[model samples]
Target: MNKSHKYKPLSFRTLFLILGLLFIFLLIADLLLGSVIVPLKQIYFSIFPSAETNETFRTIIVDFRFPKAFTAILTGMALSVSGLQMQTVFRNPLAGPYVLGISAGASLGVALFVLGFSSVISFGVVSITGAWSLATVAWIGSFLVMILVLYVSTHVNDVTTILILGMLFTSAVSAIVSILQYFSSESMLKAFVIWTMGSLGSVTNAQLTVMATAVFLGILLAFFKIKDLNAFLLGENYARSLGVKIVSSRVLIFASTSLLAGTVTAFCGPIGFIGIAVPHICRVIFRTSDHIILMPAVIITGSIVMLFSDIISQLPGMQTTLPINSVTAIIGIPVIVWMIVKNKKFDSV
Candidate 1:
């Protein structure tokens, strides 16, 4: 028996139970810890309204905090799951959703809307503030990149090659965005810059619905591929021997990752490092490579981490909130660095 297993006080079941509980606690904290510090009683009344409930407090909980908290949870889950898929598919511990430049593709789409077309289209489908304009354009850009990657996957058998090509495509898109930014008007540039900083609090309920739908679909696809993912951990040859459909599996994983990562990027402005760090954190905590356990673990852990980040961003007692992207990087980078220093062995995990 493994010594660590022998000495472990909590079984995996117990550990998961604890994590689930922690997730709930963190989620509540996320809702309650904003600048105004809505009381627990008020929050409860807001959720399950009563004659005694304060209408103003109810509005604070329902309108502002609830949406932001839910966005944080969804963003965390989507990014972490997408990262898990990327790491498994490429067999690289460092691989993440951002590695393939899906975020960059989404950024390009937003850049086009904010910088290139903001002044030109005053109305219609591509209008600057229409229902689906920004998010739809972002989806189009990410989907286009996904199509290109899928095409390349069909022709190229090497994962490294695919990664390199994805990077190249990202670089190309980024160059175009830079040019657009250079020519943009001051107002356009300011809008674009703010978008890049990312803000979880900005998503409306309707936008949250769309984001939730996309994330749910992508997560379902990932769940369906759990067996294939485990097989790939060993090698492509081993996976093929076990009857894995390599090409189809890769394409599906890619598509799923693109949807999950792209949707989060579109709404949250490419909140970084959670996707990459959360999986590693789960692997370390759960001590298992099995996606069966890792998947749920990552989901719960990701939500907790993101909620924590959001709470910190709110900076209790202060009116101004910090940019979510900055908080995530600040939290995630140290975890990653510590992981690297402690393990120094990516292949084993």
Candidate 2:
């Protein structure tokens, strides 16, 4: 008898089922565990809108928590998938939206728009002008940065070099934003400062629509490039040997990354860690690099992490909420440390 005869393949259906249940549980918990702690029965009635439903609970659930929850879902899925794509493209575990300067570029764009027009624009006034303007400028900014990164990739052979260039680019962009902030009006500076703090609660219903649309398109692009992503993981030359069009594939993946990451930054501010940490968690859970399995795994795990973070940020029975950025950093930093400790010689994902 051979050892091969005794091997049995594993099924992920069970794992996926458990994750799905966890996703639903966390989502509900996010809604129910906010400041007021709306009852599950009221949540049901709020959705169905019975006459007996408490108006206060209905207002909190339908108007505030619902949009915030949906924003978390979008943020998680967008950042996680973009992170996976970046890791695959760069063959580095550290590649992500912020690390690559994509979010910085988006932030720069927002800064110019807000700070440049500081005389008129204020924290509260951005909503009155509409969210599309903010999102559009962010898209343009991120696109420009992606184009620059692509140019560098074509000329440089080393992924480490590209990553270094990206960090430099981000630092440069931050300097420019700081200069703009210095000249900005008090109201405008306050607005930009608040944005940097990262609050999922800041997203309005209308802004959520724009975010959802952008994220959906980005995810669609990722789905189309699944084959290309799977190929790239084995190395560019190997991917080319398999007839994958390297240029076009890189363009599409970079574009998808910008859209997903930029839109999130535009709506929710510069969220960190979800993009870097979620993909690695997925790879561990699924124990495979195949994008087919990893894609869905990243989406669900990302959502769970974000929703859980949001709940903690609320501090339950407290009126004061912690910054979403701080919460994510606390959750994400430990994962990065664990990766280093476990791999010791880690260089790439």
Candidate 3:
């Protein structure tokens, strides 16, 4: 048994129960607090389908809010798990889902499809073709980048060099995207720009289904590698001594990260800060480096934070809403800053 587990077994159980209840509360809150304030009773009927449910309320709840809320939960789980994996693999406090440039690679795919093909296709109307095509291209781009990074990792002995190389790939991809944006039509540029801002509302039910599937698989992969992840925290040599195949473990970890982060970016745009910040928040709150404790903690905490962000983004009882990306950055940046300043050693992990 881990020391953290032994010291506060009851506390951990209590915390998990509390967090679970909080998650339910926030999920209901997310459904209730949209542009139009929905009564809890009406919201319940809408989901359960009683005659008491107003048609308008049902449409709002079942069609719009429910998918968005689900997206929030899925996005949160995917990014947080991916972040935890990267931080462990690299043993770097600042490492995130995007550290390997998967986000940038996805962005490049979006840019090429939106901006590159803008000359031939007018995207004034967002269709299934337009939306699904964008996501498909983004996946391909991210997968290709993952393959490249994995290849580099196998050849490169130094993890630091791999990290730097990933950054360089991101920089290169960003430069290409910039060039595409510079020459693109105004309408196409606007479409791409809105994507970058991020919006949970934009995800359709079909897209939500795909996103949920990808995130579930990614998370399942992460759970399978929990032992390897714990081994990784003590460094490669220690992990190797324990018979963890460094290269294979690294590959699986990277694959998991790519799937989780890439799918979210493809569907939701690159929502910032959640990935890098949530794991650190969990580590501090749980007071343990053990993956067993941290994995579930990160999942529930990420969902709670994201559902809260979604509620805030809705700007309840208001006509307008803030961008989801902006809300996440606002909520996450402060947590990260405080963590850094409060712990100069960055030893929370």
Candidate 4:
């Protein structure tokens, strides 16, 4: 059988077009549907202001929903791409961006800042805002963990062994976080707990700019490794035979995953499932292992899935919002279950 014809086939262009449309529609819906239910006309005016537009409505749409929607899009794309890279590099169907404990490391960083140093900083009259402090600390923590993981990857020949080390790192980090939480003040603990719950609405326009830049850079790095990733899907020795620089590719892929996953964890909290499930969903939907097709497909599909999750999280007319993490898990778990039952390889998806 022809390689491309091994699995059920669909036109890549048609899938992209449909997913693109769905993404746009969901994005618009996300901006328009919220607790307040801003009218379509009001959303229109908010984007392109008109004299007749209600100022309050326009402000709500422009200042709040727009940024949240955009954050959802970026977070989805970053995580999905990160997961795709990890799976390809590790040759593990279950591998995800967070599988290497990047999120755990970020959480540890936040725990240190919020639980360990928060009281001292608060008492000393230091003016660091909690959001900025958490983001900075989280990024540092994730970077540190990434370095450790990369180092282990270089030393160990077994991918499974590296994965085991990643899990151990996560456990160690979580234990430290628990100890910090145990010793923390009530207020500080509450704040840290809330941050863990995850919120797309929390990102401001300025933070969004930082996140967008990080995600774009990480994605560019991934794009540079596309051919190598496809080669990797065939096995490392095979990839080496094809002249793929395995060590260099691993470093670049790890760096890309770190930047993408770390930034998202810093800004949005460790969103679950999108990273693990989106790539699998893309593979099954597109029926190809080619990174050329899978990369763009995962980006679009992840963005659409996340936009839909965000819209549901908002609860539309209700005043209460669900945690973004919870919503993503609910949406992603079923897909993961299906993947397990199907028990298919990447190339055969």
Model 4's TM-score against the true structure: 0.90
Model 1 lDDT tens row, 164-260: 9768877897799779988988877776677689999877666787788888998999999999999989887899999999888888887888888
Leading candidate by TM-score: 2
| Lowest lDDT block of 10, candidate 3 | 119-128
lDDT of 4 by residue, 64-93 (tens): 988898899999999999999888887876
The Cα local distance difference test for each model comes to 0.82, 0.86, 0.83, 0.82
- TM-score (all chains, Cα) for each model: 0.90, 0.94, 0.90, 0.90
C-alpha RMSD (angstroms) for model 3? 2.8
Which residue pairs collide, candidate 4? none
Error of 4 at 163 (Å): 3.2
**Clashes (N, CA, C under 3 Å) per candidate:** 0, 0, 0, 0
Clashing pairs in 1: none
Q: Please estimate how well model 4 matches the true structure, expressed as its whole-model Cα lDDT.
A: 0.82
Candidate 2 structure quality by residue, lDDT tens digits, 1-349: 3432343133567778989999999999999997788888988999887787999988888889988988998999999999999999988888998888898889988888878866544342346346888888888899899998889888988877878887998899889989988887787788889898888998877788889999999999999999999999889999999999999899999999999999999888899989999998877676677899888899889899999999999899988999898999999999988978985534757
Model 2 segments beyond 4 Å from truth?
Answer: 1-10, 119-129, 343-345
- Cα-based lDDT at residue 31, candidate 1: 78
